[model samples]
Target: MTIIDGKLTKHYARVWDYCHELLRSNPGSTVQVGVTVNPDQTTYFHKMYLCFKAIKEAIGRDASNQVYPIAWAVVDIENKANGKWFLELLTEDLNLLDGGGFTGLLEATKEVLPNVERRQCARHICANFRKTYTGMEFNNMFWAASFSTVESEFLRKMDDIKEVDPNAYENLLARHPHTWYRAFFRTDVACEAVENGIAECFNAIILDARKKPLLAMFEKLGCT
Candidate 1:
């Protein structure tokens, strides 16, 4: 916000200090500032990532039951470096030596979530299937492939897909059955969920905040 005629606080002006103050006030806060060296040799602001106390704790508190940010970043550029830096900081702050897990950007997850598994969103898959294939049998077979608690059941349904619609079956094969199917997910985490809607919910909660100034938005993550 511009102070057209009022007193100016360091909160909006001195970004570095503001970040430090946030860290001081909130013990578990995590903040990363990305900077780029200009041609003139001076460093300029690039982007930032902030994970407040609540999220920090959520990542570190428990193994089986934990809250994980499902693919998010604060960088202007959505490239590998930015993602790697964000996750590297997150991993350091939370001591997440292994994959803590998240949904949303599978590529971002791939950069950080090792040992942790990926689950494909069944609803999204169904939506896509509806676009390419006809008949309820395809949906039923997809569901069967996803819902199967055992390997045999999943394979049987997959075979069903191959038989019914060879083209759709080929598409399904491309998506990799292990991602959505329960028969293939790791039993370590409590999440048997095949939907990535957590990202949706998280985004909705922070959507307004995301448009706010850095400090203001960063503070919102800590409150919850």
Candidate 2:
């Protein structure tokens, strides 16, 4: 389920309670929760705090069980700086590693829940690539890498690009190889699900919403 307002302590607590109850009732049953926090969104810091709290609560008090096995995905529309902010906030709050927020969360969760697997959204990764690189070559390389599952094919294209501009290859693959491109390609189906419908639907909704004043539109919809 999507928890819209992570800043509301009551709501966060309720969700945590429900998650705990669900886990307790079904021992050994794996539970996966996907969370998308837009740093540009209001109360993002609070949401990060709430996510930390949920992770801590799920793992219990013992340091041995301190690792909470929960899968969380954070989606952001801002640049890398904002993404880094969220990642830093998550690591500081949850005492995670120095890598991406999802990676840190996965490590922490695994210590307690062995079955939990964390994943990053491919859409955001693609956006990051687009933001960092400024030409069709970069775009071509990214798409080729993203769509291709075989590492050899991905690297072959990277090599092809590198032959022309070595800097591009170095820049894209400078960071963690597994986290950057392989993560998304590894689970193509998940990427397909998000890309196929959800993103388009959200874009349409956003376009429709942008045409009018948000408050007036919400009022028309009886939101308030």
> Which candidate has the top score in lDDT?
1
Top-scoring candidate (TM-score): 1
Pairs clashing within candidate 2: 67-112, 68-109
Alpha-carbon lDDT, every model: 0.66, 0.45
Off by over 4 Å in 2: 1-116, 130-132, 180-224
Give a tens-digit lDDT track for model 2, residues 1-224: 12432333454445445556546765643333335545566543222212424444222223452223222222334455444444445455455553322222233334432333343444565677668667887777776765555678778877876886777678667644454455243342232221223333434544543343322232222221
Q: Cα deviation in Å at residue 159, candidate 1?
A: 3.7
Q: Give the per-residue lDDT digits (tens) of candidate 1, residues 1-224.
A: 44532223433366677667757876866765667555787645446666754654432223765446622446656678777887777767666776755332356667676754656687787888788886788878888788898899988888888887788888988887777778877776656767666555666778766666656666665454
lDDT for position 5 in model 2 = 25
lDDT of 1: 0.66
Model 1 bad stretches (over 4 Å): 1-13, 36-44, 53-73, 100-106, 109-113, 118-128, 134-140, 220-224
User: What 10-residue stretch in candidate 1 is worst by lDDT?
Assistant: 3-12
